[model samples]
Target: MLIAPWFTITVLAGIMIAALLAIQRSGQSRYDSLVTELEQTRVALAQTKATCEERSEKKELEITVINASLNREIAERMQTEAHAKKLRKQFELILNSAGEGILGLDTDGNFIFVNTAAALMVGYEPTELIGRSHHELIHHSKPDGSPLHTGECLIQQAYRDGVVHSSSTDVFWTKDGASFPVEYVSTPITENGDIRGAVVVFRDLSAFEP
Candidate 1:
């Protein structure tokens, strides 16, 4: 009934070798799976980096285009303003050099512009006449020292009727309260067929009078 010693030793050695082989196979399989997962993670990171880089480049391009457009608009606006300023200076020079007394009035009969000849004839500085009421300053009374009503003023009527009023018998008062006859033409200023105000061109009749 007893087993041989050599057989028992050979069987025990075979079992140990089988167990060690099984463990090595399992460890190799797990190592392969870990390597695969690491590769996938690296690929995902590279894709994310590429997407971010593309978005940054697109945003930078948009910003550059916007800045260029803004710069162009600013340059155009400055050029337009410079041209307007030049035109305004030329207009002022022309008005000042005119021989006739010329003045501009607003819708309410206030003086908006008074040229050199107009200011001198009215005995006022150009600045002093501007913003002052035209009727109150120069056309407030008749030649006989009677108050002239605003409703009866021909200059006011010209703009109200959108017509030209010419008169040689009108009287305009000076700063010293002296009345002088004036030959004047009141023309309405119209824009888009709408009357805005009036411009008065006048000549002093003092030298011609007796």
Candidate 2:
């Protein structure tokens, strides 16, 4: 059998048209898949950025709290120091204004503080008596001109026993090697129920005598 020329041409055109349509449909499907994947990626990136911002905000808040606490502690310490200094000045003024001779000794019987009246009565400057052994400076001898032992001194006893002692016949030697009668009371200074030192208050008996 022989085919006609028109029929052969028609068959070739139909095959070409079908091939073109299949190619266009395949390209459209691929494009739709790519768009769906890109949308999913964008949503994941947005969630990650939000989580990072929240963590950064939380860390910043913690740092601010820590700084505030440190600042408060520093301010409280400064205030406490200032109050202590003011109290020390008040104590110094009171000691200078006292009429009786006052002496403060350390645990080792060394002079730690001597008021103005005490220094004047002993004929020495306040600076001269500080850090010196109290027994060596003025309490070395008795009223009868006998050598006094440290073990027998009442001031030393006060420091050891945490007691108060009073004497009306004791003598304290002056800086110029002279002696004067003194009536003194020695009392222990205590902290936390422990004896730390002694404080001596003395009056010149010569002033009371005619």
Candidate 3:
């Protein structure tokens, strides 16, 4: 059977149009899928950025806390040192203002400190008496010019017994080798039932004698 030429041409054009429509639909579907994937990737990146920001904030907070603690500790230590220095200055003022001779000793009978009166009584400066042996400097002899042993000294006895010893008959020698009568009280310094040293307070009795 012979078909019409115009009819065949119209049928071929219709098939070509359908094929082009199908390709356009397939490209549209592929573009939609790509858009969805891009949206998911963007959401994942935002979450990761938020997590990194949170961790950075936490680290900054930790550093701030540590710095604050260190600053507080340093301030407290400086305050303590200032308080201790003030106390030491007050102690020195009191000792220098005292009338009676004051001598401080360590456990081994070494002179740790001496007040102004003590240095004047011995005819020496306060610095000269520091670190000197107490027994050798002023307590070396008895009133009768006899040798006084360390064991027989009343001050030594006070250290051993951890008690106060007072004697009006004791004698202390001066730097010029002159002897004078002294009334001294030796009291042991103790801490927690342990004797550390002695404090000797003395006055010259020559002025008081009638």
Task: Give the top-scoring candidate (lDDT).
Answer: 2
Per-residue accuracy of model 2 over 168-198 as CA lDDT, tens digit each = 8899999998899988777776655766677
lDDT of 3: 0.68
Give me the displacement of residue 65 in model 3, in angstroms.
16
Worst 10 residues of 2 by lDDT: 1-10
Better of 1 and 2 by lDDT: 2
lDDT of each: 0.69, 0.70, 0.68
lDDT of 1 by residue, 87-159 (tens): 5466557666765677777688888767788888889898888788999999999889899999889999877
Clashing pairs in 1: none
- Once model 1 is optimally superposed onto the true structure by TM-score, how far is the C-alpha of residue 210 displaced, in angstroms? 4.9
TM-score of candidate 1 on Cα atoms, chains taken together? 0.62
How many backbone clashes does every candidate have?
A: 0, 0, 0
All candidates: CA RMSD (Å):
43.1, 43.6, 43.5
